[model samples]
Target: MARVLSLVAAAGAATLAAAANPHAAMGGYQPATNVIEHSQIVYDIEAIQTALSADDFTEAKNIYMNGKYSCKSTSNMRNLQGFVKQATYDAKLNGTAFVDAFVDGDGPSYGPIPGSGGRLMLSPTFWDDFLLGALDGTGDFLGMSTAIRKVAINKGVLGVSTLYAAYEMESAIGKKYDDNSADASGAPHAWDEGWAFLYGSHPADDGKYSAWEFSKKRDLDFAYNSSAQAVEGATVATDMLLKYFLHGLRASRSGGVLADMVAARNNIYRMLALSSIRAALKYAEKAQNPYNEEYHMEAYVYFLVAANWVEQAYAGAGTNVLALLDFKKTEAQLSSNLYCAVKTELVPSYQPLGLDCAKVGVLKGHDDTLDDNCNAPACPATQTLPTGLDSYVPDVTTTVGS
Candidate 1:
């Protein structure tokens, strides 16, 4: 009887240990080798960026619509393609003609407008009549011109990558783990797809033109001290995301608890969300004292992207935040008070998801004078800036002897 009691106690202890560390009981289970196979899409995105930067709209449109790795070909990204098309049409109809004529040496005929290093300059009415004009309507002015292609295209790619990756990870979390087969329908394949979408075929943390690059940019933007210098070791968002991806992959393959995988997935979603939110915040600060038309357009587009993602991913938790962003307002009409309210809403809304507001940091280039209006009241229906006021021109002035 004594021997039997001792044996029973040992068995109970072993059961408890197995319950604590589930993987301990799965003998001889090897983690599936990590395999990511999605570099083509990254390449396509890079090509698009290059073309847009050179003002080669033809090349950009071709790559976006017909590249081998084009998002248009992917069922999951067709909506994003639609957005690109809309932006292209608006830009062509409104701003492209002026830009083309300027680049072709007709800028002198349009008046002594500002140019960025004598490269490209639209007509003086470019901002008021085209860029900001589109912004005043409907508030969807991303990809309206070469200057802001990065804000719309690159950010859009990252948004879709992280969003669908989260979806894939969640689906894999629910399915049974298949250690033997690496087929598409298996958990391992889904996990790999999730990894591929964010990192592509590149080694961890070394990827470019995807979520990795954008996340790093946002980290640097948000890691600045009050002196406007980047603080070392302050950029943890990207690292945290990488850790979650690696750990989640391990959990999915090593017979670990599904709960661990779920935690990793949730954290990834939160970090990605933070990346966009941080970007919006940075641009909002820039919008207060916009150096040029680019800054204002960027601020609105980033806010639009971030707000839309939050609403969709968090089940409309960002509805109020979106309203505060108020895309219909012109660049000058976007008050600092409204941005402050956005920060306030974001902090508490994301707190449950482990948002450390300190990591987001304070807004750069903040101006007290701009915050005097507390409510960010609605502006007049037709908001247009005077000609040449927001144009980017060379700082050449004719001085008369005093």
Candidate 2:
């Protein structure tokens, strides 16, 4: 298992390195689950540790050809679409100035995410949506995920890396957000930042913000924050990349459906995390400032509702199954989490979109009591209206004290 895992990771690293040239020779090739596996990616890591190792142009070109096929999966394309579109959106609105705002001032929003034909983009939503689609079944998140992972992994191994290199004198620093900046202009956040941004920490826990505004970025931490979120769009991404690196190696040698399934789940869960965070952030944004502990607690319900949908998708990732096909324990988990803070005071009406909060839970008003299970018969905001189709919760600002 260890050897197989190593191979999968190495293949992706190698593929990332070999992406520059269109033609490259691979030593051993076996069709693994409809995707071409690369042995050289793992095995040849020692021979080539730096980009300079590919001394000859011919050496560089050979492995590059195989890298293209790695990211050509349909699953990867949607990722390309989500990420590219989001990046275009980000760039259009924020410009490249904030592109690499995650790690330091020089960071970007996402990663060297591969698009069609191995073109890389640094958009966080690319992988976020790919992971979400894996659970929902409306899209081919699996194929695109594998393709991108494989190529990126392979390139890293060959030392002629595609992603880690510099572009426009920038090393492509990823963007991270301070606890604030969950959204801009009070727009709902659609990725994982919402999760940590909203429910991840209590407002009083940290003192970095002027007001508890989601539009502002957080510069500190309180609870389970990740480098991905810490850097702007930096949280939860490396985990996916690392999972892909590990899974590719396992699938390479073991050649089992389980490894591939894990790889698939990694992508899905990774995105689900992002989606949940985005929703929570949006909810917090709408909740506005001067929010008390009750405000955050109530806001948490919408975020968890979003989480429930995301978890449904992540839980089913092990099988190439549709997450929304049926509600299961994970949804219950979401409900339970919601109960902790949200159901107590849900306002009413709900919406379901990519991480919509309504379907999960809602706050009626200040009477939401965690001490009492969400069995509040007269509770106005709380309802488990069957999980099918998507709708928006009515604007409960007046009722919920928004």
Candidate 3:
């Protein structure tokens, strides 16, 4: 869901190729494994930045919306992508002025209200007519199939697999909202809120949807590293928790067969949480350079904390694997494999919007230094991993970037 432009284009083309054929996903061509590799990542980042800078707003906008939530039909990526392509291209063609006017500013634009999602406006490049290609091709327009099928229809393997990433984030946040509303102690709204709890994420708290909207309108000028990378992933492990609570606490209150739905939702949430935790941990661990161990160390600490939280999810529910699944470790010895953060950060520091209060490293008898590893005093950053973010370590004597 957070894939950059080149990835989206590549995915779009791939989806096109796949839809054209019966076996594109199964055997069309191997998708690039370097989806998240550093050079490729940095290059894509720079390319998009440069494109935006050159006021090649047309190409850039095409990249934004088409990439976020692509629409691949039964035939090709091109068929489904035109509407968004035009909408995005128009947004970029108008530049920031258009974005402000239509998206969030004072001109004629879509408001926060759901009914007014957005509209299709053609760019100078494709002004064949008013509604030829721009208005109808976009899946987000009216009645797109609300299913996982949409995700697969529009993405390359890497992009599609990560679709679940966005889904999980949105769903988790939705669960949080459900949790909030259900706690209101009113039976009607509480009953009204059951659909939200037992299903995937909702339209209201959808960060991806908002992000996609930002792109569609060209307000996507956000600095990637600065704003919303994997902030969705951060909550992946947390939201599965609502499932446990629902299964344990609200299952009785499910008003009959809704209880079964509760259990199924719980299972789905558990699978998503466990898989997301495992996948993100793999990605974070890959960031380790010789001397740098900051971002992922924080991630590890969170993983452990999430692991601990999962235990509470199943405290009295008898024996269950959902808790054990978080860290991919057995509950009988989760402590041994787990790492907890004793170090702390400012209470909500991940964004300019705010900082997050969190313990920062895994607590272990182990050391955070090369000396502890019986190596030199200062560990060296390698070509495989570039390590410079370790300057703010709380307890390590041999800190990098100090």
Candidate 4:
């Protein structure tokens, strides 16, 4: 009996230690070996960005479309929601913001725009537009099915597949709000509450998102180093995210397939899949403590970005179809619906009065100041300036005679 008791105690101690260190149980998040698809998409986006920079919108659109079609119609990346479920469980058990913990110390990896930069900052505009594309089914909006199909065919190793899961998530969540409401209706409103658990607060208790957390902790067994250059695959990642919104704004305003707008939409979905996979692999490595509430909260919260992004892609698909068919009147109606969606569903409400159908397109520009200045209450200038706005620098101006 004494020996048995000792064995039992030893086992319990081992279990406790393992529970304390999340890295020990999952063997750390090993990055996928086959990143060719991700690499290809990155290259394709770089080309698109170059075209946009050169004002070759037509070429950029074509490239974007081709990248969209590059994935197969089916995915081998199956049972991806298992990760989400597990992450949710982990968050319930631990309070960590596992994936987004990087953004705080790392700075804005996602953008010049406010919510686009960090994990906790939610974007209802992004949510509204994505649902429009997914439900419309004009093209591969989330790019999940195609990506999974390709992954299955190529037998590429994936740590977790996010796109398909995102599709199902939007569908399931959107169903809750299918009935038209006085506030935001159906898809738009449903997508708005995805990360409700972490709403208002910074993703981490420290009030930071830890953008470079993975890279800094790369020596750990679970951390995967993405060999690609650029922060999150270059500034192009951030730019692509911005372009998707830009394209939607332009499409809503133009009311016609002005250029390769379809391609741009598709390309953005492709980028979404690639980035999600890269980030997931990095985060999975550090998801060690199941009892740590923050860990679980963050793990669950991390997936919301992809969820919200794909919703935008899905919604964009629908909106693009309208542009393609030249349904000016109907398109205008949907844009109005989108304005209401943000107003009602977004907490702290998206304040830009110009986001309505007639004004949004006009409001879209390279200058993020529009978003910064146009919010309902308006973001403070101190919060919106470029990185070096305050530091001392040599003034270039010269006086000929003082």
Candidate 5:
């Protein structure tokens, strides 16, 4: 027990240290000045959101299907458009009724988010399918706002952008580069594309409406309050993620070895998984409160996203994580106990990714009394990696990106 506590303390210290000097990557890093051509996709997504707010489905559909954004040309964004178009169509037909169900009787509001705009939570299927289902009248409208803002825009657009970034990273790995121009062919262009998808038109410091905002939201969600021990915990995960991207780009530009690029890509993947886990934990806490359907859906969407990455991080434990984050569970079935189990299950998955599980802090604004059963023995203070994962290596290292 003493040794476990010490390990947890050390992990916290390491996370704080990384948080304090996130740019400690070899050679100082700067945001790339190249134009992120596809970044307008994020803007397009916001426009669609605004259109939906005004019950302007035709306008939303036009922006989604006919927008002049460069990202629309990308295969990934194009793939997402079909889904977004369907959602927008359903919204055009049913959104007014859905909005009427809300106490506010208006479209989703952006003011309540951690940052300035809507929350950009991601999911490949759970939220995606649910959003479509809700809009099509198969699912309840109780959480329809969450379905639109989080799933349709965030998952369908920004999340797909991040996935594209991941694709670019894979493309850049083990490849030779001639120059670092954004227009350059091969690895250089791929690296820039990765950066654009994640950072998108806005500077990193003031990033919005893209994967950057999602990362920031997770950072704020998991951040511990200021203390003598750590002043920068709030942005630790976000900073680390940015640092990884910058480092990876530098390696691509300078013709560095596959190992460096691989390290950066893996770290980015780790942070993605960590951020998803943090989000899941946060909404799980919120879901424990009675009478908030949105919170329940939020918890489920993030947990589903986290599960996808967790499966990648630890192949052997994939089934267990998926079971814990089951998409079939209804709002009433989501509980603190289930999330507590999730937290415990995920603890082991963090170590191999170089993340400190202990730093997955509890989100503020929740009543602790509500989650009393999740503490201590029920959830356990320490959990070991599932029996085989400690020895099982992830396939991500060996899979070549196309």
Candidate 6:
């Protein structure tokens, strides 16, 4: 079993580096002659944004749920559409109340999440509890509003973009980049797919001044707070990420051996994973107050998601890059320390407010809970709370006093 797991991880890493030149020795292949068109998802987001600006959220929500909008034209696959469908189904099953509560702003509030029909990937019930608790409207609306806004823009909008770009890359790599086919345009197409992930359909001809010009624009607007330092940090992070994507995209465009381009793509994916983890940690920092347990927990949800992505991306990297990032240490921090804490401390203690331990997210249907009990071996007898992520330490000593 361990050997199989190792092979699977190695295969995943190797595949990310698989966009090799098909006719490397033939000497007859021409340089890419075509420009990759803007993905259909780009226009879909434009329309969605228009609806949002017009306060037509009902229509916007419908468009999002149905996946009726245009997807990437580069590939016949409906990767964006599939993601929308899955997201909608998950939301309905686990986050109906959270989505609906924010949908109208004045509609029905948070309600019970339904039982798992298939199997839970992550628990919406636990997520909702943290979000509701964090955003109780007691301290201020900034934290709550920021959380919702980030969710809407990052998860809803840019999430589609990332999936679309990844799908295009998959198509090119799977086909081995044969320009003779409609789906494959060699390095140019593969590079463009990755470019679109960070920059969207935004024309590069225009001057790039602000970090907001890229996918991280809405991120800045939604993560608003009184602290100037926090905003500045987000800005810097967004810009750094943009620079990496842009450079990688250019490298991909410049005619080269497929190995180099593949490495560029892998590194870009690595940055994406890291940037997301940083964002989650920052959000977690904002949710540290005892009065804001909900937000604190919700931040971890994002953290876990980011950590999972990093695990996958890091598995794809070469030894040099792996050593530079110290990925094994990072993975231990995520899979061992943080994972154990979430399983033991965060989820169980919040149960009195109606969280169900049995429903906590298990890995691929395998329950790792201690003795298969949700509340047993309760948060170590010596420690008041889990250690390690002290930056996200929750104030468990006192109840919120209004």
Top lDDT prediction, candidate number: 5
Summarize candidate 2's per-residue lDDT along 298-397 as a digit string, tens digits.
2332233223223223322211111211112122333333323332222121211122232222222222344355442242342222121121111111
lDDT of 6 by residue, 32-73 (tens): 222213323444555556665665655555554444334334
The models' CA-based lDDT, in order, is: 0.46, 0.25, 0.25, 0.25, 0.47, 0.33
Instruction: Flag the better candidate by TM-score, 1 or 3.
Output: 1
User: Candidate 5: what lDDT?
Assistant: 0.47
Candidate with the larger lDDT of 1 and 2 = 1
Identify the superior model by TM-score, candidate 1 or candidate 4. Answer: 1
Q: Cα RMSD to native, each candidate?
A: 21.4, 23.3, 22.7, 23.8, 15.2, 20.2
Compared to the true structure, candidate 2 yields what TM-score? 0.22
lDDT of 1 by residue, 1-402 (tens): 011122223323554321232111111111132222233355666766777677675665565555535232335432223322335324432222122222223222212112222222223222223322332222355434545544445444454444445445644664533342233345654655566556543222235667566777776666775676876434456767766765665566535556566556656655666776776666655655444455554554454433433443333345555455444456555554556666655554443444455555545545666456544333223212111111111111112110
- Stretches of candidate 6 off by over 4 Å are 1-43, 46-57, 65-154, 175-184, 202-255, 290-305, 313-402
Candidate 2: segments with Cα more than 4 A from true spot: 1-237, 252-260, 263-271, 278-286, 290-402
Candidate 4 ranges with C-alpha deviation above 4 Å: 1-235, 289-293, 307-402
2 or 6, greater by lDDT = 6
Off by over 4 Å in 1: 1-36, 69-150, 177-185, 201-205, 224-235, 303-317, 326-328, 336-338, 363-402
Q: For candidate 5, write residues 57-174 as lDDT tens digits.
A: 5666566555545543345343335432335334431222111111112222311101111112222233345444533435534444534343433344554455556656655652
Winner by lDDT between candidate 6 and candidate 5? 5
Model 3 Cα displacement at 283 (Å)?
A: 4.3
TM-score of each: 0.58, 0.22, 0.22, 0.22, 0.63, 0.41
lDDT of 5 at 210: 71
Task: State the lDDT at 295 in candidate 5.
Answer: 57
